[model samples]
Target: MFLLFSCSGAFSEVVMAREKATGKMVAIKCIPKKALKGKETSIENEIAVLRKIKHENIVALEDIYESSNHLYLIMQLVSGGELFDRIVEKGFYTEMDASRLIRQVLDAVNYLHSMGIVHRDLKPENLLYFSPDDESKIMISDFGLSKMEGTGDVMATACGTPGYVAPEVLAQKPYSKAVDCWSIGVIAYILLCGYPPFYDENDSKLFEQILKADYEFDAPYWDDISDSAKDFISCLMEKDPEKRFTCDQALEHPWIAGDTALCKNIHESVSRQMRKNFAKSKWRVSRRDVIFLYHILPKTNSIAAATLHCHGHPHGD
Candidate 1:
């Protein structure tokens, strides 16, 4: 009963397959054996992480099967679309709305960290809606870069989308699950202002900005954003990972748990900026390119070099 499908990456495609007997639809990631030649461990790590995670805000892996030349990973189908798309479409967006979204993400990442799993790559594209319903909860997807802690040395990979990566990661310093918290802060900043905290077409400049933790809540775009919201982002985006707010601390902050997230509608400004900044073509950079550039940059370079085009929309509603 495999019918509908969509290409998700270079090596694997996600198909909406239905179980014949149960008549339930699920997303099946099909990976060709040839594609697994040198990346077997990465695939195994992703599967291992998916298998153990059962949070409501995180996608679930239902089953796994191997064919003669392919491996199939059955994942819970999520169809609401990307987080940015929904925010851009909403007519009455506010700080409260952004707060709620970040809260869900924080809770999910918190659960992962507690279990010793670090989601090294957390970005807007990976946050999907469970269904098309207006009130559907967000679901986290794409754990290909995630790593379980205590299994190996501390993570020092210069990975993650350029705009949202933590400073420690860009500095090539050993990092913890705090990297996920930093990404959440970046997302929160964009949700309120309708643009990334850091942006530059040049990979070097972009990495330089992130490495220095250089960003601002510029006027007009951030005029309506509450101070509490800015404070919240600052805490998570702290240059020192050791001082960066943990998921638990972020959740307890007034902006998230209290009533500081303003209710004023900022959709006009926020959505307009979002559409201008996050066009489909601009978000098409390959993940492989980012990783490749990170590994090849000279150790003495001013900053890690990596082009970051962004965004992804999940198929199957």
Candidate 2:
């Protein structure tokens, strides 16, 4: 009943299925064994990052089933399709709609950064919609280029699309979650002006414009957009990575501050609810199986350390 999701990096297809027993609809992502076998470590990292997260704006992993080689993730599927298509058809968002979408996307990014996962690729294509209504919910999907930092060393990956990539990322400098915000700025610019701030027929010229950080504004577009919106985008798209607001800080910007209660609820866990579900599970395991669960986990670090089996084997799922 639904179309497949296709992008450059992911050969994996999205399949619509109904559970035989419950007759419930599911959107399943299939990564064939051959396609992922050579990239086992990356697949594991994606799974690890996705599992650590829980939020309304971030795509949820409903279940994960793995075979000897392939891995399948059943996720919450949004029916409204990608924001890129919307932009293509309608041109851009009005100020009111842009505010709502930015708030939702920031909430998701803040949660991910807090969990030590950097969504290396954040673009219009990666933002999915929940329905056709104007107030439709949004989510971040496609974890193929995501990464988790485990060490003190900063990451150095020449990834991300041209127009939205941060200066640090394009310069091949070590960078962090700030790169995602750079893309957010680009999105805001498009939403307000109905065009990207930087574009060129030549790839080199496009990179120059991105690094130059020059954006266009005319009374027609700028007069209607609030300063809070412009300032928030400017603060996030700052040239210096350190100066840019972390996802947490950006969520509190004047444009989105009123809705922080929505963000707070996402990180708050209901252990009581989880324990109740655990009791109902047919597959039982001992407390020892978990080894240990951290009572408190901050946003900047991980909840647990890597485990070593008695026979000297590394294991994490």
Candidate 3:
């Protein structure tokens, strides 16, 4: 067994190991029984959800083992690292590239939705590449916050990374699988411009911005991005979940399915913005702040319906 880096959760650690007979490398997530005192259901939920999912763009959970002290989850080992890091390292990036990546995510998400699963948390950090090879595929990981929507049930959990969260979720409303589509829109926005659509120094202000669907495609950064691409994002980020594009709709959008002739090298600008965003620690703070706020915020529906009424203009005007 080789000790890989630790996983994200406070209760579990992920390590890479080799199968004795087959010599196949795999990732083992070890969750201490003690740490699951009140959250045993969460672990069971994750296992149940992951076991039901099988897609090229989603990670696979192969086996499970339990001991008196810990439970080990064996999974596919993905070595390519985070999607954004790979994008930053690339010399050439374009809408076509972004479209391909988003398409994979959409495919995985569509499959999940078909299975009545909602990935509440969808963000760049959770997207990983299968390997370091050039042809590596993107794989969605980290299903800790995913929900299995059963028959006649509604998902009331307002759980997700703040900036990428849907407006309905921030409003403390019971949401549907549509929330995952909203997150994909946020990811698409970042992929095109190399910065998040909604951003603020203050957490409350950030939440407000997301709630109002207040985001813009600023100059220089978005000047070269395709109009069709903007339209695709706008449809996904619609304030009203009822109007937001489903995964199938997004996949069929013009930007993703239409022209692919304008694949320009956007690496310099994208990488520059990525470095700036990371250097300022905005993304890190947003992650921490969202978790803090998700628990402390009032459960009442405080956001008015008017605040959630953003014009879903295709051009993002």
Candidate closest to the true structure, highest TM-score:
1
The TM-score that candidate 1 achieves is 0.88
Question: TM-score for each prediction?
Answer: 0.88, 0.72, 0.86
List ranges where model 1 is wrong by over 4 Å: 1-10, 286-317
Residue-pair clash count for candidate 3: 0
Tens-place lDDT digits, model 1, residues 19-105: 654666566666767877877778888888888889999988888887787887777877787788898888898899889999999
Tens-place lDDT digits, model 2, residues 1-317: 22223211233544554454454455666565676556677677777778888988877778877656545677765667666445444433345666678888988888888888888778765777865666679878767678887756578878776677888988888888889888888776665555566767688988877777766655654555667777877887788888988778877787777532122121112223223322342212211100111122232332211221111111121
Query: Each model's C-alpha lDDT?
Result: 0.79, 0.62, 0.76
What range of 10 consecutive residues in model 3 has the weakest lDDT sum? Answer: 308-317
Candidate ordering by TM-score (highest first): 1, 3, 2
- Top candidate on lDDT is 1
**CA RMSD per model (angstroms):** 10.6, 15.8, 12.3
Q: Which residue pairs clash within candidate 2? A: none
lDDT of the structure predicted as candidate 3: 0.76
Candidate 1: C-alpha lDDT: 0.79
lDDT of 3 by residue, 200-297 (tens): 88989999999999999899899998888888999999999999999999888888777852589888998898877855655652231011000111
| Residue 111 shift from truth in candidate 3, angstroms | 0.5
